[model samples]
Every structure is written in structure tokens, then in C-alpha cells.
Target: MADVMDIVIVASAFGMDAVRAQGHLKCAQASRRAGAAGFEVRRELFAGEAEAAPQRLRALGCAIAELGLWSVFSTPAALYTADGRLDAAALRLAFDEASALGARFVKLQLGGFVRDAAGAEIAEQTQDSNVRLVVENGQLAEGGSLTQFVGLFDALAREEHAHVLGMTFDIGNWAWRDVAPLEAAAQLAPHVEYIHCKTTMGEGARRFSAAPAADDTRFIAVLDRLPRDVPRGIEFPLDATRVEADAAHYVEWLAAV
Candidate 1:
């Protein structure tokens, strides 16, 4: 068997609708009970704006820390704006929110990133922060395409800014962009420090996030290519009725895989 990876249960996997109904506090308890090594808090999942306030986040952080699970903060906001400029205010808020939560990493989408001199600014913004930022390939071509990632990383490298940025490689996201996961892993694995474990299930092109089956060779193949030391997050949907069992099962299975 290969080395086991740490499993991080993304709160949204419990279902966005369900989370909105109960809030993430309950989910955090379940995650720790399932023996997850970490938990990912979705910014978009917060029930209200006040729930994400700094003081509330600090309290949540304390609660999570007491459970003995490390955390990662995820924001739906993209790292760049539509015009290819760095969303500095968005970036700063993300860091503040993640920092308040005492998270190890803040995950963001690589949005509208056109290669330019602005890539270097990432280092300056992150230098004083305790939390690190890792950009993920989203479902669209603008920031989610393989070519886009390669270009962004390349530009940052030229400016010596690559060291400050890392990737959250989502295996299932490639399908949305019509890109092959294995091919992406082959090129982007070097920069990947985290993984989102997902496989699509559908009757046609309109697929949805589903847990990878035990015998799923495609998931294993892509996972094998990424860094073994990196953490794996269960981003796929968990059975709503059996969230406990499903969460526990994947937490163990994903780690062993």
C-alpha cells in the first residue's frame, strides 16, 4: 500500500443546503468525530455575514482547535478580477478571515489571471500573514484551464514570486474544462500541495460531484501523481442521511489511498 495521506473534510461536502440550515459548528463536531485530520470551512457556506465576523471566527477557531483538527479556509472569491488585476481587497479579506479562523491555508480560485507584472504582488501581501494561500483550478476556462495555470505560475516564476503560491489540485475539476486529469497532474503536480478528492457521476455531460468509488482507477491514477505528503480534502457530496458514516468512511479511505 502507498503512504497514507491526511484527510480534510470540506464542510460543504455535507451539502450547501444542509450547511445553511444548521451552520458549520455542527459539521465541525462531526468532522472531528470522524477522525479527520483537518476541516475546511467554506466562506460561502456561512449562514449570515455576522457568522463570519472576526470574533465569531475566533471562537470557531478555538472550538476547532479543541477538537484537535487543523483547518483550511475556502473562499468562493477568485484571486483576480475579471480584468486580470489582482483583487487586493478580496485577497486581504480572505487572509484576515482565514487568519481569524486560525487556518493553515486559504484556498481561492485563480480568476481572470493574465500574466503580467502584478504576479509579484502576491509575495508582498502574504509575507506578514501566518496563513498561506493556495489557488485552485475552478470549473471554467478563464482561470481553471491548464494553460492558464501554466502561464500564471510561469509569470510568477520569472518575478521570483512562485515560491509564495501553491496549488490545490482538484481532480474532478478538469472534467468541466474538458481537460484530462492525468495530463494536468503530469504538468501541475510540482506546484500542488493539496488535493480535492472528487469524481463526477452523470448520465451525460452534466455531471455532479460524487465520491470516488473504491475501485476507481482514474482517481487513484491522478492522486498517485500528486505529492504524497500533501493533504487530501473530500470535496464531493456525502450522503445527507448518512453523513456520519459517509464522512468516517471517506476520511479513512481517502487517507489510506
Candidate 2:
């Protein structure tokens, strides 16, 4: 029989520093704007350095499939501030750091809403890194529109750049565009390399949502439609209190998949 497919829940949202706390390692923080709740690492932590964290994760008895590298405001749009354009250099550094740590993928935002020279430059630098770049289709203002994002996918899918680039489609982002998550997944499934399943709950203006990433009906429908080879991940943010409980919920929900 084929091995059962498994989904990986990345722990970076809990802060790199949280990895040291040992108490709140599985805390949910994917929803935070700052993504700085748990632990914060000033430098990269490689496979050897991360062994303790991973071992601790294993002891929790939850299946962690793989580790993900995450960054806040590291996109092309964020490269330039009052100082100068540093997106390329920063990305190179970040990618190398992620790669050194044995991370399977690196998650990044496009920087800003506008897609200009800086955006192009950022994308170019990502392509140059030779590591897998998993683009998150969230926060639409920052070149996150489905149409524009697909354009990037198409460009990257070309013969010359196809192997080095791909996408990490975040299911809930489309809901903000008023597009159904399943529909959005259908549209981008072909270009997707990984998946982060979550949901937003709002109607006519005032709406918020939550998740057991793989449990939501909309997310399940999207998963049903997707090719099984794609790796799906659970991502959500919760306060420190819900860490263990939420991780258990996530593990149970993932098993249902």
C-alpha cells in the first residue's frame, strides 16, 4: 500500500526565539501581523543547531513533516526605505540562511501593493538564489492579486526558469478578493508547489475567521481537487495559551485528510 500522505505545519510563526523556550514551541502565530510572538532568532539556525527544536517537536508526538523558513517584510517592495534598496542583498542572505538550516522551503511576501521596478528586482533576485521560493498569496495590496500572481507563475513556469521557481498558494487569500478559495485553488493548482490552508470569516465588511487548517470545508474541497503529490501545510496564529491544544487539533484535522 502507498504510504499515507502527510502535511507539515511550519513552526516559524511562533518566533525563532520561541524555539529556545521549549515550553511554547508549537504555539500558533501565523495570524499575527508582526509574526513575533514566540521566539526570535538573530541569526540562522542550521540542521545541527535545529536538532534540539526538532527533537522537542517529535517528543510532542505530533508529525512535523518539514521545517519552513519565514521572513517578515523581506520582499522587493520592502527593500527600499529611507536608506536605499537592499532587497536583493537581504534576500541572498535570507535564502542562504534558510538553505543552510535544511529548510525545505522559504516563505515570502511580494513586498508591497505596487508591482514596479522594485518588485521585478525582488523577483529576479529570488530567481537568482537557486533555492525554492514559495510565494504567499495574501495581503493583496502587496502585489497579491490572483491575476498578477498568476502572471508571475507563468513567467516563472517558462522553460528557462520553471525548475527554480514555483508557488505556495494560501487558500484564504482569495476570499479577500471575493473569490471562493476552491476556485482560486483550481485556478492556481497547476502552478502550485506547496499549500497553506486557512480561512477567513466575514460578510459584507465585518468578518474574521480561524482554522484547523486542513479541517475547513472549503480547504478540504480545495484539497480534494488538488493533485495528491503537493504538500499541504497547516498555518494559523493563536495566543500562547492555545499552543498544545491547537497543535493537537491541527494534528487530528490533518489525519482526516
Candidate 3:
């Protein structure tokens, strides 16, 4: 909602070793120094269960707020289970964690969501939740299929439950499922509330996230198609050795582009 594009630095972008050793509190400080509008706190990046406890998260949230930065809580949990049943436990935990962090959004994967009769169940579960719930396309075919997304949105729309959930469009993740990023963007742009900006490198099983080249037209094209007002997360790897140095530059570059 801020006039300036919100540049979010995913904790993992700082690399696992640094995040694990220094903890997400340090990473939040780096994100603020790098001029990021928001910091995405990853569930798996927490040093241990103690660091992820409610009390720790509340303290972390207070610290982050003092830095004048917003937060997005990303959990690897899925909204639905493999059997197309809602994973109430995962969803509840995600919401509770996000609330504790005072995050603006809570991101999850759209797992095994083959269909939904109506969104009443999901809407009820998410009712009164202050944090926005967003589903990201997974890196695997089971949850990343373009067809599944189209169907899911269509169904949500019919039931007027679209407001209950938003999309986290991860450009690089499409490569893992062999889907064209542009094509997916064109169809899903209307529902996207966040963008995971990155270019995938390597091939097949070796594919990994990397920063986009300056003149990468594909990256430009994808951004053009999606809503410009949404937050863009730097999910690509940054220079861990140098810590926050490259993050600021990328933040500036991404905001301009």
C-alpha cells in the first residue's frame, strides 16, 4: 500500500549458513540497512525450535518494527494435504506464527489442491486473521501445475472466496515444473499479491536460484505482466560473504526495473 515498491529480502537469500549462525534477528537488521521495505522470515531458517517459539517471535517482531520494516512470514507448510483435504494444523500454525511476528502476510504452498467445492471452509479458517494468507506455486509438479492454479482461482472466484487467499508468484519455481513463467503470469497476475523475483540457473535436477542478468528481457516481461503495486521478494541468492552489500544494490535495481 506504500507508494514505493516494497522490496522484501527473503532470509535465505543471505544463505543458510549465515542465517543459521547469526539468526533471523541479524538478518532483519541487514534487510533494513539494505533499504528493504520488508523482510521475509522463513520457518526453516530459524536456528532452532527455541528461536521459533512464540515469545522469541514476539521479541523479534518488536525489534523489526523498531527498524521501520514490515515482515512477511513464509512457511513451507501447505494449505491442503495430498488427499485434497485442508491441512488445518499447518494452516493454523502458519497463522499463529505470522500473527506472533506481526507479519503482513503469511505465505504457504498450494499442495495437492486438485479442487475445492467452495472456499467456505478456507474462508472460515482464515476469518478474523489479520495477516494475509498467500499461496505460492511449489517447485514440484504436484503443486506447481499451471492447470491446477487456473482451476483453483476459477473456483475461488465462483464462490467469492478470492479475497481469502492471494498468490505468491515465484518466477524461478516455474522452471522446476517446466511451465513458462510469462504464460503463468498472464493468467495469474490478477490474483498475485507478491512476486518472488529470481532467475533459475543450472539444468534439470541441478536447477538453482540466481540473480537475473541486467538485460534479461524475460524477467522484464514477467514483471510487466504482473501487478506493479505488489511486493517483490528477492528470493535469489545474494553474496553471503559480503552480507548486506549486494542486497541494497539489488533492492535499488529491482525497484527501478
Clashing pairs in 2: 15-39, 16-39, 17-39, 17-40, 18-39, 112-142, 113-141, 113-142, 202-207
Better TM-score candidate (1, 2): 1
Model 3, 169-195: lDDT tens digits are: 999899999899999999999999999
Q: How large is the C-alpha RMSD of every model relative to the true structure?
A: 1.3, 8.4, 1.8
Worst 10 residues of 1 by lDDT: 114-123
C-alpha lDDT score of every prediction, in listed order: 0.90, 0.50, 0.90
Window of ten residues with lowest summed lDDT in model 3? 1-10
Candidate no. 2 TM-score: 0.62
The total of clashing pairs for model 1 equals: 0
lDDT of 3 at 39: 94
lDDT of 1 at 177: 87
Q: In candidate 3, residue 187 scores what lDDT?
A: 95
